[model samples]
Target: MKVVVGIPSFNNAETISHVAKVAAKGIMEFFDGDGMIVNSDGGSSDGTRERFMETDTFGVPKESFVYEGIPGKGSAMKAIMEFSLEQGAQTVVFLDSDLRSVKPWWVERLAGPILRGEADYVTPFYLRHRFDGTITNNVCFPMTSALYGKKVRQPIGGDFGVGKKLLEIYLEKPEETWKTDVARFGIDIWMTTTAINESGRILQAALGTKIHDVKDPGKHLKGMFLQVVGTLFELMVTYQNRWMSVWNIEDVPIYGETPEEEIPPMTIDVDNLKKLAKETLVVPEYVNESAVREVKEDGTLSLNSWVDLLYRSAVQYRKTRDKTVVENLLPFYFARTARFAEEVKSLSDEEAERYVYEQLGVFLERKRLLKEEWEVEDKG
Candidate 1:
């Protein structure tokens, strides 16, 4: 099959060269002379453009590289899809720009199932560091599995492989299938979800090693949570009828049972939890303005307003749980505001940092307990 590897890059100058060379090598090894590598960049300020222009030691010709206009990851992927179709590529494999542990066989593994017609979409599974988006596994994976009735282990995994037919379907229904959060973290989740819902065949492949840089667990939790879970929830609600059909399929698998593998251990910092809680408290302001509207004569928040905010947040975050989790967690909605208010009221400017840290310890411990309960339910 004619295979084209697309790398969606931003300001990835520091690591682009290595990623390109390794990916190029993988393509050449797997598909022989029929494989090509393309990088669709999002107008990087760094010398990424110039770097791609430079010579590559990987025997693949430099003419195979093309840089497109500024757009989100989805746009970049769209560009690559157009290019791959134009070039008559039968399959497309996408690798992230930030991959640090890519092996020579990575591309082969991702595309193997698709090339053989065993799966329509393939995602990577790897050993990640403790702080690497573990919340994705805890929250996103189960929600996707339960809702869609497919065992897509890495629903938000950046690397993926897709057949030409699937790519055409994706392009045909861009608004419905394409992800809007292309620049940040939402693109991957969008693709995975779309594949599961549209393509009956989807599978996860073991990458056998961790890839990409280690991220600060707490630093990105809120943003990651908001983008991934938020988008998922919206999709779930919007496509409720479709998902209900998927859920009712008795033969469908609800969980991935491919042997328990060891993943990197993550530690939740108390300070980070408090910071996230405080940050989440800001949702009401945005919600009140965007998702929630004041009704009646008074300007006070109405019940519909509260429900709208909750729905919007849950939709945007893709928080998947039974109705019970939603009801139980609804109470914590006000607690978020109260925590922020308490932080502001009790702590002086000089003491605020320390106070938050102290409060975070208690908050995270509570989170741990809640998580334990969720885990019990998940396993049971």
Candidate 2:
């Protein structure tokens, strides 16, 4: 196979060289040094471009390292995909620039299924640290399964391998369809979902170890939620008739059969966590005011608000699978709570907690009921 590895990077100068080296080693093992490394950068102000230009670090040929002019992760991937096709690459694997534990074997493991023709797409399964985002496990995976009838455990996993045919399909599609905010976080989900919808077999390979540095979940909560949920909602609306047919087919597999292994918990800085929480919880006064007014006026929110809620929910969904949009809306939720608190100034602390939780519960219940009805109609 004419394999090519594409690393989509942004300000990852410190880690990019190491990833390049490791990937180089892997490609060298399988192919006779024919493998190439394509770095699709989002105009890194950091020395990421310079680092890649320094040929001593990665033993691969210098001609293989190409920089793209685009700005988003999706754009970066698109650039690499186009370059790979022009280079006559038959198979391509994408690796994130920030991986910490990427071994040479990781590449082979990810691409194994595709080479075997057992699957068209390969996603990574890893032993994640406590603080890692679980949105893939909870929301992205299950929802994908329920909607598309394919059970890919880590639909949004950062690392993936795909064949040339799939790459061509992705490229031929309208750029606007795959190159938006959802594309930023939803690329993997979108890819896996599309592959499944097209009857392309999907597989998950064990990485044996976590690969990337963990970031503050709170900092990413809103963005992740918006990206994931926005992609899903868009899929729901745009492909309503298709997903409606597959909604209750129930062939998607659930994870948890893999044996659990002991791994050290990655420590999260308390100060950082607190800071992230405070920032995330502060709910921009404008977002709250506008969202509330919009909801009250139309009894429905705009696509943007729904996008924001999805992003926030993705963060919470990672922490707890049961989390829904209503559960993740706590930050914006205070707007209504403040009004209720003002109306009943004498309520005790316990009473206030109960009242807010109850209100949230009621809102979520109503949403669930409506969603259930929608699903029923869809399935019908």
Candidate 3:
């Protein structure tokens, strides 16, 4: 089967060359058939395109293009999709251009299942610092498992592989009101949710460890959290019928290497988040000052409180379609996260992951409230 490794990039010049060359080696080493590496750029002012083009591709048909779609990661991916179709590529593996710890073996692990016809989609499984992906640990993984009834740990993890059928499905999706959902950070979760709700043979590849751009959760999370969560709520509407009946999570087979050593202990500055929480507690339309203080002081919220703050905000975003309302949810998120950090500060990483599942049960118990709020009563 023809294979292509696609890297979506923007202002990633510093690391794109290394990622490109390693990915090139990955394709050349793993795929016995025809293969190439394609860099789909989003008009990076940093000259990422030039750097990628200048990199060696071992005589492979590598090409770089400025994407013409929504001008974000998803559009860059769309460019690769178009190219894959044009070249009659049967399989495509996508890697983030900003990845610093990407290894050649990752390509073999991600693409192997697809090439063998064992799966239509492959998601990455990696060793990440406990605090590294707080969003996933707090929201995506648990929420996805409870709602979709399937366990895929890193739904928005950047690297993955897909076959022609799944590629065609993603290409056929129309992004109108929720363009941002399909545009930037929303793209990853959108892709994973699509694979789950729609029919696909999915696999997870254990790609050792991930070491890339790390950002502080309280500061760097607002924009990404808004986009990813907003897109998640939008998809909830689209796939309501499918997940409504999914109560049991189906297991998917995993391939490649799993981490051997214990990842080091990771921690976050809860005091900083607490201070931030105090500032934003009463800021806007959604947050209640009293409630914020109540949740913050105790470093935890009751199940009712959690549902009221998060699920209600999700419902509001879905109904009003106001980006501001989503932004307003930031303070509450800050407060809740601070509380979560305080509660989990003493636990080991494995214990912490399990503790998060208890939080998921609370979400599952309250999901009906969300369904009630999400549905509109029709008048005759």
Candidate 4:
């Protein structure tokens, strides 16, 4: 097979069929039926696999099976990659099963660059609501850009296109790596960072607006937050040498035009979010006491303090490898997110996006602080 489109799913019966159909259409129409669609399920009882199997691929080959190993998206992806490798596929495009707005052209957009030998890895860039992807907008995007010297707008965006070489390297990761958060929600950032650090040719595919099952950071993201942020901090320590030597940010090449459309409005309970932030009263020793006091008094975390807290926690994690170092940052994350929601509540989507980048500038400006703290801890 020349191309393989893999969908990693759980209980997505409500939406997998649509994703499968478009994936098949994209593969057949763009790749000339030389592609296959595979669904690596997590044993969903919701008939997600059945729905996927039932979809007609217009003569394109398809298969659905429960993947083996710990039940997580990473394991599902590994199964797909292993299968793709066995089949001698050159390009693999992985799509989330719960996506609602994926188009047939998305397959071409993601896999086309790789097929043409222009890029080795593809990351999706979408026009999303101001409140959508709080973790990406607040943490992953900024940190990845600053540390890695490349401005990849969505480091943890779920959809991606992987070339064969990167796929092999990903599968070649040590056995224990998959057992950690990388097996769960941490997978996306792990793949993106690996591509950057490995010196692969990376580019962003402008997939327009990504309408997926959106989650509010305040209402439903504690587990995901911990896993992804923990993985990110761990990666920082692992790639300390690479990031320390990198200084300027370079723009990544884009594959398509930016789309203009109205983003769906997301609802967030700001008062309840502030309540959750307040509940995180036991601050970690590494976090500055004055920052805690300021959040307590103002019910918001400033960008400067947020950066300070993150660097301190990263230094502490490097020294101790204590997982709670990530846990302790949760409340402050909540506070920072709450502040972000309130600040962007009334702004237009364009303005909100600019604000997000402006926040990114803060992280970039304070890169020196993280390096200094990390070096101090290493010497001690």
TM-score of each: 0.68, 0.69, 0.90, 0.98
Query: At residue 98, what lDDT does model 3 achieve?
Result: 86
Q: Write the per-residue lDDT of candidate 3 for residues 1-380, one digit (tens) a residue.
A: 47899999999999999998888788778775368889999999999999999998777778998988676788888789889988898888999998988888888888888888988889998787767787787678877887888778888998989889898888887656336657878888898999987755888999867778787777788778888888887777678787777667666678965867556455677777767766665545554455666755753444457556777777676667777776776666666677677776777767877776666677677777766766652111
Q: What is the C-alpha lDDT profile of model 4 across 1-380, one tens digit per residue? A: 77999999999999999999999899888888899999999999989999898888888889888998887888899899999999899999999998998999999999999999999999999999888988998899889989998899999998999999999999988999999999888899999999999945999999988899988777789989999999999899889999998878889999999777667777877777778888875677677888898678866787789888887888898999999889888888888888888899889988999998887678888989889888888788
- Pairing residues by index, what is the TM-score of model 1? 0.68
Residue 213 Cα positional deviation in candidate 1, in Å, after optimal superposition = 2.0
Better of 1 and 4 by TM-score: 4
lDDT per residue (tens digit) for residues 25-54 in model 1: 887887785777788888788877567657
Please give, for residues 132-249, the per-residue lDDT of candidate 2 as tens digits. Answer: 4435533465466555656555678778888877888888878677546534765777777777766456677777556576654434455665566566655655555566565343
TM-score between model 4 and native: 0.98
| Ranking, TM-score, top scorer first | 4, 3, 2, 1
Off by over 4 Å in 1: 55-57, 62-70, 174-179, 182-184, 246-268, 278-380
**Per-model lDDT:** 0.59, 0.60, 0.78, 0.89
**Number of the top-ranking candidate, with TM-score as the measure:** 4
User: If ranked by lDDT, best first, what sequence of candidates would result?
Assistant: 4, 3, 2, 1
Model 2 RMSD in angstroms? 10.0
Which stretches in model 2 have alpha-carbon errors above 4 Å? 55-59, 62-70, 247-262, 267-372, 375-380
- Greater TM-score among 3 and 4 belongs to 4
